[model samples]
Every structure is written in structure tokens, then in C-alpha cells.
Target: MKIKQLKVRNFRLLDNMVLNIEEDITLIVGKNNTGKTSMFEAINIFVKTQEISFEDFSQSTYFIFNRLLRLINQVDFNSISERRKEIVEKVIQNQMPKVQLFIEVEYDVTNDSLINLSEFITDLDENRNDATILISYESNNSLSLLFSFLNREKQEISLIRWLKDNIKAFYQTKCFAVDKDSDFKKDIDLSFKSKIEKIVSFEDIKASRTLDDTKSDKNKTLATGFSHYYRERDQTKEDIKKLEETLTNVSIVLKGEYEKVLKDVISDLNNFGVSTPITIPQIEIDSEFNSESVIKNNIKYYYKHESINLPESYNGLGYSNLIFMVLELTSFIERFKNSSEEKKSEFLTILIEEPEAHMHPQMQQVFIKQITKKINKAREEGINIQLIITTHSSHIIAEAGIDLDKGFDRIRYFNKIDGRLEISDFNNFRHKESDKETFRFLKQYLNLHKCDIFFADKVIMVEGVTEKMLLPIMINNVANSLNNEYISILEVGGAYTQKFKELLHFIKVKTLIITDIDSVDGNGEECKTDFANAETCNSTLKDWIPKKNTIDELINCNEEEKFDTEFIRVAFQIAEHSNTYVGRSLEESIINKNLIFFKSEYTKDAINKKVKSLFTLINQHSSENLLIKTPWDLRPKSSSSKTNFSFDLMTFDEKETGLNWEVPLYIKEGLEWLAGICMVNISEK
Candidate 1:
């Protein structure tokens, strides 16, 4: 049996959250303060402690209680009718805020043993194999008693303060077994604790581990683990006998040495105590040893490299942390294996928080890659172990791969939207039948690139290396507010930018896609921007945003039509210089906006040869007007290196090289919009 899902209500930031568990490993990833720790604590509270407090309640739930209090305070109880009084009492009973957890377990009826899960199953259907357990902390006090307490203290203290102080007096925790199909709940007696323990065993390795290297340290070490393992495992009679004999012989030798060392003192004490015929006093020395004590206090772990031997503390923290985690995991698995036959749990859950705390990227990748092998090794001992890892490491995520059936589907993304926790399961990311190849390519690309867009506040998908290298400088110049936020700039090019549409929507991050117009004429031949009957060859333009193919339609499209959603906006080349002409690509757009800068004699040797040649051609064509009738006529050809052109721009400075230039109008507008949205989001959070 395995835990299929977990639902939590009114618990801290996880006001109403449902988490679907993977069969073997579930990876929970997110930014800070998004309730990753709260989910861990919720499981710890319900399964291990069963303790609830006022601080555990969500802030939203607290406001709910305050509203209920106001409703009660406004009513005049003495003048109320019988029906009205009943309704008020019923509302008070039903509307009280409570923290709850629902654990759903799935079992195999035909092949698996039901010894641990049989008690929780109430359905008689032969096809059913699922059971749910509801654990809740609710008020147990009567309304009359609560009202009396409130009246006595209403004027003495504020209602919220009073409630905080008296919460434990009225609240209690209860457990029930719920039927899967009928939704009928049966109260499991106190024995429910044992039953639940037998169904699942939980172990948490918290982030803040004590890894002190001093001699006085009392943390878990390999030496201590050995003692624990020895105690838990059965020892043969022959081994016990041999150990006892060795200890006895050592004790005898130590006793003789102690007597010889204290011989002078013993004689003086005997002489001082003896008096004539009275019994003489004797000073005796004894040496005794307990095997367990000797092993626990005397043993130490060491690392041997060639001819050198050093203590475990002598190693660096990265290796120490890795070794410590392996030891802890091994101990947990061994403890499960040694449990009694009838009381053994069906599944062992190990929750590890931030395993990359003290490790480098390579070590983190190794840990993620090896975890599966370790778990499978444990299964060889007839133990079922389910692992949940909460991490902020992109390296680990990248190494896990993004295959729908085996990789990225195991990821659970936790995000906060409008001050409420939201969870997006990658397993639910889907695509149409025609987009299967696109999905496959995306998975491969993400795995190879190690993209951290999953954790960014906003995303900018650019067309090429030119945009990737120069966009930062543009943002700093025009949209400085975005510089302070976590923005991921990805160079997905125009062809594949639309492929990430579903993923961006799934994570719900604000996105700005910057691409080119790629104008073409009839017969699908590339043409200038002002050519007759021009149409866009860019897939993102024709199929994604605006959904227009004609150049005239696209140029006249309103700003609102460019937005795919409130969170996504697409920007491309547009008309410039009071709508005199339009540019087709980024290079052409740049030259159009900074015509004088390119025409200056100072920039003749500072720019790429192909770009300089294009500028010369445009200047030659427009000698009289100094403004080309068609800007796209002098566009750079496909042979020109855009990356080298961008590199040339990188070598100049506004103050030193007289290379001041403005961002294209479309990109600037998109950046400003993204900055405003992100700033508002940050303020709300």
C-alpha cells in the first residue's frame, strides 16, 4: 500500500491544498515562503505528534472566526425566537474554523496483504481498494459554555486575545476512517493510532542539521549508528559468548594493573583504619566494563586515503554531509526491516529537506542520481520506501530529466498567487496529438540546458544570441525596475517559443516573447517589409499572438490583441519614425531607429563589416532625404553573423565610444508592461 494523496485545510499558508504523491519519489520545489515547509510540518504534526495550536491556524481562517464572532455579537439573544436561536446555534457549530488533514491510501486487493489497511476500508464492493483517513482539530465545547466564557471576559480583553488564550480548552483532535465510494465516515477508536502507524512510517531529515566538528558534539554520527544497528539486530549465542569472554579477560588484566598502581595508598589506608584486634580495613580496586557502553563511548569514524587516516571531522562539510545522509537513510531502512512481522508498516516515507544545503552542484547531481538506486536496493530486502525531497536546487531538477512518464512528472511546483499557496503538478502538463514531437523536443532541451525558469518571477523568451546578450543592457536602460526582480531570459528562437506556451501557463509566470516579423511574399519567398502582398512567415505571429498573416493586419493590431493572457505578452518588429516605414528583423530595426549613429564617421570601423555595408547602401539610396523610403530594402542577409554584430555593439559605450542607441519601440513597451506587472505582484506579496 502507498499514500495516494494528501489534502490539508486551514493550516498556515496551505489554506486548501491537495498534493498527489508519486509511487516512488515526489520532488517538491519552489521559492521561499510558498508553504513547502508548511506541508512538511503538517505531515509531521498529524502523523507524529497530533498537536495543534492557535499559531498553526491560517491567517485567513482567523479572519473567518472574527466574522463569526461579529455575527454572534450583533444578535440580541434575549429577544430572539426559538427558531432563530436554533439557527444561530447551528451556524456557530458548523462555521467554527478548524485545521484538517485527509490521507488517502491505495492498496492492491488481489496480490497485496490487507492486514494494515483492512480496518480503514468500509466499502463492501469487491473492486474498491482505496481508504481515506480524516484527522481534524475542532472545538469540542458546547455553545452555552463558550458564550458564558465569552461574556465573563468580553469586557476584560479583546475577542481575538481571549480566543488565543482559551483555544486549547475548547479544541480537541479527532480521527475517522472514511469510505471512498459512499463518503461515509466511521470513528476509529483510540487503536487508530496503532493502525495508522502500521500503515505508514514517516521519517524527516530536516535542513538545519547539527554538524559540529568539536569533541563535545552529540549529533548523529556513523559511530552512533553502528551502536543502534547492533542493538536492533539479533546476535547469535556464539558471538555473544565470544564477546563476553574477551571483555572478561581484559577486565582481569586491568584490575591487576589498578591494584599495583595504588599499592602504597592501599597500605596506608589499611594501617590508619586498623586498631589492635579490630577488623582491618581493606581498600579494593575493581575494573568492570559494559559492552554497549564501551562501544558507544569509545568508537569513532575515520576516513582512510592510501596510507593516511583521518577522523571524520577532518573532512570538508560537503563530504561529511553526504556521508551523514547516507548513514541516516541506511539506518531508517534497517529499522523498517527489523520491525516485528505483525506490526511492520506497509510503506516507509522519508522526507529530506534541502539535501543540497552544504554540497556543490556536482555533488547535488550525484545525490539525486543515486537516490533511486538506493531505494531499489532497499526493496530487495522486502521493504517499500517512498521518498519525498524538498529542494531549491536546479542542478538536481535538471538531472532528473523531463520525460512525461519517468522524469518531470514527479515534480510538484509550489507557488504563491494573490497571497494564497498554489500547487501545480507537472504530471498534469499535457499537449495535443500533433504536439507530441514538440513536447519531446522541449523535454530534451530543458534537460540539456538546465533551465531555472521554473523558479523565476518573470520570463523573457528572445529570438537569438543577439537578444540574449544585449537584452540585459536594454532592460537596465529602459526598464530598471525589472533588474531588481528574478527574471529568466531564454533564447528559444521564434520557431520554438510557441512550444513553451503551455508550460509558461502552467507555472503562471508573467512572460514576454520577443520575435521578428520575418515578412514574406506570395509563393512563400522572403521579401522586403514593404513588398506588395507581404505576409508574415513567423509561426508565432501567424499562429500564436494576433493570429494574423497579412503584414497590414499585423502592423495595425492593437496592444490588447498582442496579449495572450493577463500574464503573457508578445512583441515583434513594428512601424517606426511616425509610421513612415517598417523593419523586418532585429538588425534592420536597430539600424532604422539609430540611423544617424550608424551614419556617423566615428562608427565606420567600430561595427561589423556586413552591418556597415548595409548602412552604406541605405545612405547611398537616400542621399537627398537621409531617410530610406523602404527600411527593409537594406536588411542584413542570412550570411551575416547576428552574434558578431551584437559583439561589436558590446565593445562600445555611450560615454566613451559615442555609441548611444535606444531600444526598439516594441521591446521597450513590452518590458515596461512586464515591469509594472511584476512590481505590483511584489508589492502584493
Candidate 2:
């Protein structure tokens, strides 16, 4: 039987969160401290590999002293008469609020043994082949006893004794597995021990950070199959002696061989010195090769070079971790295979944290794609193994994205909502079945470099490479900070920017789209005359995003001329410095504001020469009195690009010139809006 779902309450960060586990493998991913580790801890505690500690209590849950203090703060002791106020204070100080957890677990009941063992089946969907069990565990504090102690008027009753008694009353967790049909209060005798022990077992392999050699490392005793070997065989006096003798014989043989070579050297040295003879020192051997030392001395890691052994530690960290992981995984399988039949527990949940710890990106992808199959093949003894991996690696997530056909729904996304942890299924982002097609498209498009958008606090969707290169610099200037907030500027292009709408919406990150109006004629060429929307601007946007009713409202607010906010979180605005005229592209919109800085820096520069020529042509062509109001106006009709222009602006020596490069009005406004919204979104939690 596999675990289907977990519902936890009053746990750390998981004040109320439900996690749905996929059958074969479930990948849990999120930013750090969003409760990825807490989710695992809740499950681990429920399954009892680990028990709940005092610190595991949710931040919302108050302890005895804190609860009493809150109550004291709420009361007006001065309002009552002096003696009565003292009694009111005593009453408030005497009691505390209790912290309780109501955890519900559901399992897919394929095994007959589990069905027979479970006395509390909350749900049994015959069509789905599943059974669910609800468990309620709580920390108890006796309020009646506290009231009794306060009501008694004894002369010289120690407050310390009363506090100690109340504190002890709340220290223990009372657990009960709840049955659906029966009264929950009456079913206090229910325990999960008989049910869980018969059906499931848990194994957690935390993120491995080995500081020393694996052979002697206590943290990874299974690295060389030493743990498995020890488990299978018992060591006695004879075993110890044999291990010691093995070491002794190897030492003696090596020492003899060394002495043969040293014999000639000593004689030659004695002749040269004309004094006492020098010789190689005798090799030392321990009297007893203990279990710990035996493995360290005998199980040496080596690489073969010309049939010679080289130390494995001599390799890179990536290689060492790869080898260590392989060995540990093999040992885990062997241990599962060799389990006795009488135990009646055959299921294992393997919790792996950051399996891509030391591996390169390619190896990280390979690990995610192949590790599950390897685990399944290794568990040939018919032991059921479920894999739950937590990772921050983009390569691994990409591999998972590619495997949508198999189990994309298995990926669990964890995020915090207003300081409370929320776990959502991967399918929650899929608005419809057609979104799976978009998923395929996105999976192909998001490579290692682009996939970093998934981790950013906020995102800005731009039309081309120019915006991607220049926007971050503009944002740093507007926000007046560098690297304080991570912003991903993706060049999704105008035509396909809508592809990421649902994804950005579901991730709940604020994103701004700085798109051009793209005013086009009937032939779909750039509009040469007056700007009017027929095949471009709001009409194209409306056609691209028909479902968003909000953009229709933005059009009512005159979107034909300038960019405007479609919504608070996701905004779409035309790239323009002024409403009087529009730029066809991002570079065109801001070029005028940049001319003064560029001209002063280098007049003889080749790029500036091209810019000057383009400006002269624009001035000659314009019949109207246009003063080159924006950068887009001076953009050349030829293949002259803005990438180099932006590069020059970014790399300009401000300290040498003692002048700051001015950011264009439109660009600055868009960046500031992005920064403001992102800051607000982040501050929400």
C-alpha cells in the first residue's frame, strides 16, 4: 500500500497544509524555508521515525508562560477593587492554552495485510481502491485542576509549585487514531502502532555532506557495505584475530620488500658517512584491528591507472559524491531485499534531500531521469519503495518537467502564504487539459539558464534580447539597490509572452510585461503613417488573451496610445516615453534620452557615428516639428542594433566623468512599478 495524502495541522510552518503524494515518486520543490523540510518532518513524525519535539510546535501555538502573559495583557486588573484585582491576576496567571495537532493520513490499500490491520478506516473508496485513516494527537493541559488550585484559599501556597504542576500537565502528547463511524471522544484507545507497523516503514537519506573519507566516516557507514556486512555477521574473538592477522601479514610482507631495497641504500650510506649504519624503520601494526579501524585500513578507495591503485579522494568532489551515493543506494536496496518475511512490513519511503549536491548540471539531469528506475530495479525482492526527493536544482526540475507523461502530477510545490505553509499539487497550475500542451512547449523552451525564472522573487516579461540585457541595469538604478531582490527578465517576445501567463499566475509572483504596441497595417508591416490599432496593439493582445476580461477594461481606458496597468500583479504597457508618438521597439522608445550622455562620452566612436547618421536621417524625414523626443525615434532602419549601445551605457566610467547617466522616463516608470509591486508581494507574507 502506498501513502496517498497527508493532512497536518498545528505543526511547524504547516499550520494547515495538505500534501498529496504520487504513487511512484513525488518531487518536492520550493524556495528555502517554505516548509519543504517541515512537510517531511510532519510525515516522519506521523510515521514515527521521528517524534514531535517541543520546538516542532507551530509559531501560532502558545506555550504556558506566553499564553498566561497574553491573558494578563488583555485584563484590566486596576478596574476591579484592589483585592479582587489580585484574584483576577491570579486566575489569569494560573492557566495556559494547549497546542494540539489533528493529522489525517490516507493510503491506497492494494495490500490485504494493511486492510486487515487497520481498525480505523475513515474512507474506503471501492472504485479508487483506497482507504484513509484520521489521527488526532494533542498536548493536554488540565484546566479543571488549574481552576481548582486557584479556588482554594490556602495560606502560603507556593506559586512555583503550582506553575511546575501545570507545566508538567502540558508536556505529553496524547495520540489517537480516529475511526469515522465511532464517537471520536470515546475512541481514545485508538493507536496507529498496530496499523502502521504492519504496513509501512520509513527511511530518510538527508543531504550528504561528508567531510572525511567514507570508509571511516561514522555518518556514512554503509558507503562500503560495512553496515550491511556487520548486520549480517557477528564479530567474535576469532573474527577480530583473523582481521588483525590479515593486516599484520600484509604489513610484514611490505616491510620485507622495503628492507631489500633499503639494504643496498644503508650499506652505501654507511660507506659515505663512515659512522653508524642507517636503515629503513620497521613497520608498526596494531594489536587489534577494531571494527571502525578495520574498515578504514582495509576498505581503501582507489582508481585504477596502469593497473595501479590511486586514492579515490584524489578525484573531484563530484566524483566522490557520485560514488558514495551509488554505494549507499545499493546498500539500502540490499538491506530491503534481505529483510525477514515475518516482519509483515514491506513498504519503504525514501526521503532524499538534494541528490544533486555535488554533481554537475548534466549529471543532475541524468540522476533525476534514471534514479527511480534504478531504485525499482534494485528492489527486485518485491519490496515497495516510494521516492520523495526535495531539490533546488533547475536541471533536476527540467528532467521532471520532461517526464510529464509519466508522473508530472507527482511534483509538489511548497510555498508560504501569509507566513503559513501551503503545499499544492503540480496539477493545480494546469488550468485545463490543453495546458499540458503548453507544459510541453515550456519544458522545451526553459533550458538551464532560462529555468532560473522559476526561483526569482519577481519576473519581468520583455519582447527581445535588448530588454533582457538592459532591464536589470535600469531596475538597479530605479530600485537603488543591486542584488537585494532577484528579478528575472525573460525575452519571451511579443507574440508568445501570453504562453507564461497561467504559469506566472499560479506561482503567485508579480510580473510586468513591457511590450511594444506593434502598430501594423493590413499587410502586417510596421505602420508607416498614423498609429491606429487594426492588426496590432490592444487588438492583438485581446486576440492573444481572450479569457482575461480585465484587459478589455484597460482598453476602455485608452490603451491605443500608451501602456497601462492591466492588473496590479501583471501589467502590460506599450513602450513609449510620450503619448504623442510611439516607438516600434524598446530601444526606439528610449534612445532620445540617451543621446546627450553618448555624445559627451565619445564623439569619434564608430557606434556614435552610426547613431549620428540615423538621427540626421530621422530629422530630414520628419515633416512635423519632432525634436527627437525619444531614443526609438533615432533607431536606424538598417541592421544597427541597440545591444552595443546598452553595453556602452552600462560600462561607462561614471567616477571618471563625475556625471550620472540618466534613465529614460518610460523605462524608469516601468522598472519602478515592477519594483514596487514585487516589494509589496514579498512583504505580504
Candidate 3:
């Protein structure tokens, strides 16, 4: 049994979000400030409702009353009497906004370990074995009559309260059907509260909580568990009484040994024939023995390595924090086991935030994997367990990967869209029954660059390594727009660029795809083809974007024209240029546009001896033959080799040609397009 779904409203950035839980391990991942933490907090608030603090409220909630005050004052509140202002202020204080969290859980009805929750389980809808718990923190509204005389304020308060309360009805949960305009409000009945208490063992391991302060205090660590296990579980009071008696007897015996050791030390000193016998001061040892004093005063945890023993706090933060997490996990599991079958619950949910904190990259990767495996092993031993991890570590996600067979999704993505928190589930991103191997490759590719896709304000996907290496320089020097945009140039190549189509759309970043126009001169009939597979224009780029949506005609005639044009017109320019490449690849296009630079930079043998003009050059060599390296060829792997060759030409242009190399028309047009779109968005903002 596990949490089947979660719906949250007015909780920080997550104004309204519904998340489906289909895996044993659910990874919440996204860029920072995208409400990943907010989602986690919402779950925490639901699971630990009695433990709510003022800080748990959303940032927007705190400003709600203040904003209302300003609005009221600006309109007509200044004309009100001083007594009216005080009443308005008092009412405002008590009418601050609220946050709510709703959770849908799937549980096994036959699990005897959860007998304490049997009543609530029976109360669930007869058609389904699921339950929905709506936990909310709302302001007390017992003072509604005070606003009646100021009738406008009454309407405002009533509407705001209705908006806050009725929005819960908008969420559809597993247990109940919700209409958008439904007015049902869930009060925590005894059965519902019992289910919340017994059905799930939800524990939150916050990132901010560290071992530094409590490492030396062994009693604080053990007291809760000790009290719960020995005192809470044992209905018979005789067990604690037996424990007290055993401790008292043990203390007396231990004190005798201590006295014997002191006497022996004094005797040894006298036998050594010292001039004066050293007087030893006797210290009082507490005779009264209780669990608190015994554990707190006598027991202390220390880090042991071979013959070395150091206090727990003496270790480095990474080691200590890992140990602390392990201790917490073990204690949680043991507490679940310690309870009697009738009182215990079978389902446990653990929420971990930023598990990579205080750990190195390698440790971060290994830690989560090991912990997840252990958690699954625990699940196999009869406890139904689910782990929720919120992380920014690509290493952790890569290690976890996407394994539907083992119930691991490819980490949900969260981001802010239109100033609201929106999440795209990994399960929805791809089909669950699809080939897992391709998904593995995608994760590996994304993990290689540490998922830089999250950092870009806009993204440019390119087919080759050369494009990835040189696009930044072109954007900076030729386009002069590097500072204006934060763009990620991903070298996913043409074949796999489609893998990121859904991802880019989810992040909602502007994306430009640049690929080579691998044209084939088939019997002098020009047909565009894919570079890798040699299929006639069957590229991932084609699959991702429609030809109709793109420019109808190629802008290839102006091989040297600059595009100081409208953003929409220039936005996808190079894709159109590819349509006009009769038989030229990106490398061929570069050489054709800058023949003088290529000819002067490379050896004379590298160029076709018979070729003199750009027109003759295209006619003489097919795209494939132009780049095929022979012994006489000066460049290695012509397509990729052009990157270094062009780089050299750009670097030493003044020395060789006594002028800076002119930016290629296609490259300039593409960069300008990307920059223009970014500039337009910035200006609009």
C-alpha cells in the first residue's frame, strides 16, 4: 500500500497541483525555485498536521492580508472612523489566507498489521479500497458578524473565504468524485483522523536538520524510541517495573567492580615504593537507576575504525550526516517492527529533501542507490514502503535511472509556468510499456552533462560536436548576443534530438534546433537526406517540427546577406537554409561561403585542383565525397574537422588574410534569430 496521489492548493508556489504516485520510489526533480520544496512541504503538512508552525504557511499567504489592507485603505478606508479602522484591522488579522493539502492513498484491506485502522478502512467507499485525506490550516472565522455593518468588507471576506474553502472541491481524488463547483468541505471525523494516524508511517528527514548539534546527546536520540517501545507497546505495566528492577541490580554490581578497580590502583601505587602515597578523591556515583539516567549519562555513540574511537561529532560532516540518516532510517524501521501486529501499520512513506547535501558527487550517487535497495529489501520483508526524494543531483537521478519494472519513474519535472507551479510527470512524458533501453540511453546522455538543460533560459539542440563547440563563439562574436541570453547548446545529434522535445516543452524554454542539410545528389536530382541513416529527409528534426510550420522557401540565394530583420522572420532561418542546400552539408556550406579563408588556411592539395568558384565546387564534389578523408586530405573527419579548421581561420585571420573572417550568412542568421526571440521576450517583460 502507498500514496496513490497527492493534490495541493494554496501551498506556497503549488497553488494547485495533483501528482500521481505510481512507483515505489518517486523522484521530484527540477531547477531551483520551481516548487519542488513546496510540494514536499505540503506532504509534510498533511502527514504532520498537529506539528504545524507559522513558517509552514506559504509566502503569498502572509502578504494576503497586507495586500488587502493596502487596497481597502486606498479605496475608502481612510474616510472610516478610528474605531472602524481598529475593527477592520482586527478582522484582517484573523482572516489571513490558508493552505490545504489533500492526499489519496491505496491500502491493503486484509493487512492484519493495520487492525487499529480497520474502522476507517471500512468507512472508505465500497467500490474502491482507497481513501482521501484533506488536511488544511485555515484561519478561525467566528467573527463574521463584525463585518456586517461594513457590508462591502463582508462581501469581500465572504468571497475570499469561499474561494479558499471551495477550491478543495476542484480536486478529484481516488476516494471521491469532485465537481468544479462542489461546496463540500471535509471535516476531520474520528474515522478520518484515525486513518491519518494509523494507515501510514510518514517521516520527513529535512535537509536543514543536521547531526552537529545532537551528536553528543545519546539520550535525546534514544528516549523517544525507548519510551514508545517499552512503555507504549506493553499494555501490562509489569514490563517497565521489571526493567527498573534489573537496572537497579546491575548498577549495584557495577559499582562494586568500580570500587575494586580503585582499591587495586591505590595498592599498586604503594607497592611501587613511592615516598608519599597519592591520596585519591572519591566521587559519588548515582545509585538510583532509571532508563533516562542510564542511557543519557552512561551511553554515548562514537565512531569506531579498527583500533580508533572518536566521538560522533569528531567525524567530517559528510560521514556524520550519512551516519545520522542511516540511524534515523534504522530507528524508523525498528519502531514500525516494535509495535504489536494489531497496532502497527503496513505502509510507510519517507520524505527526504536534498539527500546530496554535505556529500561529494560519488557519495551522493552511491548513497541514494544503497538506501533505495535497502528500502526495497524492507518492503519485501512485509512492510509496504515508498520513498520520495527531492533532489538537484543528476548523479543521483542517473544512478536511480528509469526502471518501470522495478517501479522507478524517470523523475518528475517541476517548474514555474506563468508564475504558477506546474509539474510534468515522468510517467506521462513517455509510455510505461515502451522500450526501457532507449530511456536508459536518454538518462545517460542527460547525466553526462549533469543535466544543464535545467539551467538554460533557452536551448539550442545541434546534431554534431562541432556545432556544440562553436555555437557559443558564434553567438558571442558574430551575433553579439551571448550576454543577452543564457542558452544551452546540447550535442544530442539529429537522431536523438526528438528525445528532448517533450522535456523542452515541459520546461517551457524557447528552443532552436540546428542540424546539417545532408543533401544527396542522386543522379543530379537534389533531395535532402538525413546524415546518419541516409534516409530521404527522415530526421528527428522533421519528426519534431512540421515542414508546413517552417519557412516554405529556402533563403539560400543570399549566401552573404545579414538578417537585421523581424524576430519571427529570422527565428528559424537556418532550417530554411537547409532546404536550399542542393548537395552541401554544414561543413560544405562553411567552405562554400568562406572559400577564400579555407583555401588560404589549408594546404593547396586539400582543395580540389580543378575547382575555382563556389558554383563549380558544389558540382564537382558530392556532400559525402567532399568530406571523405584521403591520405592527401589535410583535415581529419571533414565534418567534425571543419570546427577546428574554421576556429584556426577565425583565430589567425589578421595574420594570414590581414582581416577578420566574415561571419557565415547561415550561422549569423541562426544566432540572430535566437537572440532576437530572447530580446523580444525580455522587452515584453
The lDDT of each candidate is: 0.78, 0.57, 0.56
Please write out the lDDT profile of model 2 over residues 188-263, one tens digit for every residue: 3435554555566666667855634444344432335454444434344488568667878876687767667677
Give the per-residue lDDT digits (tens) of candidate 1, residues 68-161.
7778878888999999989998888778888988899988887678877877887888887898998888888537535755677457776567
Could you tell me every candidate's TM-score relative to the true structure?
A: 0.83, 0.72, 0.63
How well does model 2 score by local distance difference test? 0.57
Candidate 3 lands at a TM-score of 0.63
Q: Looking at model 1, which ten-residue stretch has the lowest summed lDDT? A: 676-685
Model 3: CA > 4 A from native: 49-97, 112-125, 142-186, 189-195, 209-317, 340-343, 404-410, 430-458, 471-489, 502-510, 523-543, 546-552, 556-640, 646-685
Number of the candidate with higher TM-score, 1 or 3: 1
Error of 3 at 213 (Å): 14
Report lDDT (Cα) of residue 651, candidate 1.
Answer: 63
Best by lDDT: 1
Question: For residue 52, what is the lDDT in candidate 2?
Answer: 58
Order of candidate numbers by TM-score, starting with the best: 1, 2, 3
